[model samples]
Target chain A: MEIVRIIVLALAGLLGGVFGGMGMGGGTILIPLLTIFGGVPQHAAQAVNLVSFVPMAAGAIILHIRNKLIRFKGALYIIIPAALSSAGASLLAGLTEADVLKRAFGGFMILLALYSFWSEFFSQKARKAKLPAHDAPTV
Target chain B: MNGIAKKIILLACGLVIGFINGFFGGGGGLITVPVLERVAGLKTKSAHATAILIILPITVASAVIYIIAGKFDFGYGLPAGLGVIAGGVLGAAALSKLSNKLIRVAFAAIMLAAGIKLLFF
Candidate 1:
């Protein structure tokens, strides 16, 4: 039983890391897997996801850097503000209710999924038709 | 907009991305990539790559907070993290071979499924 649990967690992490290294946020999938399938509490799941993300990102970043894919100037612009906000928000998360956080996360994921679909399917075509010579910016 | 103003706006957007990361543990890239592409004038792949760098510091900061707050569990987290590292290497290698459009479709499908499960069941 103990080994089973460890295996499950490791599998979940593997899935998360795969997507995460692809530049998609793995926690979007990992948190849900941990809470719903792994029987971890929501807050603990989030904590674990965050902690695990460090190694995953580190691994991916090394490859990206070697490939010269990272935009250092842009990254520097975002890092300081983002790091500060992340710290502040984490403290807030620690205080929030688990159920509420879960629901909110669910809603956010649904919206993101819908937006991704739209952008990929309809929006991409529309943008290409409108600007044949240039790739329009996406958001 | 001017260069400095554009950068400032990007920084502000980072704050929002960071907040989301801290609150949710991950998902900052969803916002980061698009914003970088649209606001920072990066190519899609570059935006994706840069998002990883942007999230690294935020994740570290959030993880530290979780650790300090006694929310992080090392025993479970360590093994999972090891798995993640291995997976990350594989994914990074595969990225060069995969189509971006295909990746986007897969990402949407996974997020949709995960979202529905979380919301309904």
Candidate 2:
């Protein structure tokens, strides 16, 4: 069981790195594996997932930056509020019920998968709904 | 998915993953691993380890913020982080040889299974 846990956790990290490189949350993979396969508690699994994410995000961000795909303006706009919320939420998660959180987390994943499925399989609708092009007017 | 299409899907997933990471602290792995394996055709181990490597930056940055704000618990984080580093390296090596489809299928099945388990079991 220990060996299995190690292998699974390691495999989770590897998957996190590769998919993370292509721009995705490896946690979506890691937490479930940790909880179900590795027999870890939900809180511990979530914490581990967050800790593991540090390196993975760094590598992917560097790649995106190297490719000139990162927009600092956009990143900042998003990161500030997110950072604050995450910190606040992390604390809240500690007080929250574990099973409730897990179910909530599962619901979140379901929504995300549904969104991904919709975007991938029915992209015509997305394109039609895409934000319209806007040009800044010169003063 | 075709190469261009796959990339597009990955990017879309990336945006969602990024938002979740920024707001939730961990989402990329949960989100990306399956996409890379199922949509982008990456091997499972490769996809998993790669997810960790990629998550490092964002999480580190977030960790920094947390640390600065006195939210970090080094006693807990440091010991586990050592394990993560070792695990990360092993996972990366394993990924190099696995088949893509197996990776994707394994990822998807785990996700659905976990989701179901969490919901009812």
Candidate 3:
């Protein structure tokens, strides 16, 4: 049973990484996989995702930095506000009920899926009229 | 555009990104990439890479809070993290060859299905 659980979690991580490593938001699916299938609590699953992403992203971020793929210019503008607000939200999340967070996440996921569908099918065509999309990969 | 205007836009976008990421524990990259491209005027590659750059600090901050809040689960987090790191290599290597649209459409379906399941079930 322990081995099976490990396999399941590992598989979940692999799936999340395959998508997330590609920058498609692996945690979106990961949290759900944990809660719905793994019998993991919502808060724990979210924390797992957060903790897991650290090491997963570490090597990639370093590679990106070494390749000069990252632009440091004006980055603090985004980082500062993002860090502060995320910290605040993190506190709020701890205070919120698990079910409420799950519901909100469900709603957010649906919205993101709809937006992704539109972007995949139609946004490029519309965007074509504006500027050439030099699409690039990041994770 | 102008420097101050761009800074303001980045700052506003950052606030949104951080709140979403911290509250949910993920998805910052999705929003960050587009913001980097459209608002920051980064090329796509740069946007994606920089999205990671931006997401890392926010994620770290959230993780710290979550851990301190007593949410750490080594049993759940370890294997998963290892798997993600392994899969990251495959995904990165496959990125150049894969048809992104195909992958995305398929993933989108899964996302919708998962969303429904989470919502009602």
Best by DockQ: 3
Best by TM-score: 3
lDDT of 3 by residue, A27-121 (tens): 88888888877777889999998888887778778999899888887788999999999999999999999989988888888988999899888
Candidate 1 wrongly placed segments (more than 4 Å) = A129-139
Best model number under lDDT:
3
Model 1 TM-score is: 0.90
Tens digits of lDDT, candidate 1, B1-121? 6777888898899889999999987789789988877777777778777888888888899988988988888667876777777777777678789997898788888778877877776
Score residue A92 of candidate 2 by CA lDDT: 62
lDDT of 3 by residue, B1-121 (tens): 6777877888999999999999998888888988888877778788888888888889999999999999878988888788878777777888889998898888889888988887877
lDDT of 1 at B89: 72
Task: Supply candidate 1's per-residue lDDT for A58.
Answer: 78
C-alpha RMSD by candidate, in order = 2.9, 8.8, 2.8
- Candidate 2, residue B32: the lDDT equals 52
What value does the lDDT take at residue A35 in candidate 2?
67
Compared with the true structure, all predictions reach lDDT values of: 0.80, 0.54, 0.85
- Which CAPRI level is candidate 3? medium
Judged by whole-model lDDT over C-alpha atoms, candidate 3 comes out at 0.85
DockQ-based class of model 2: incorrect
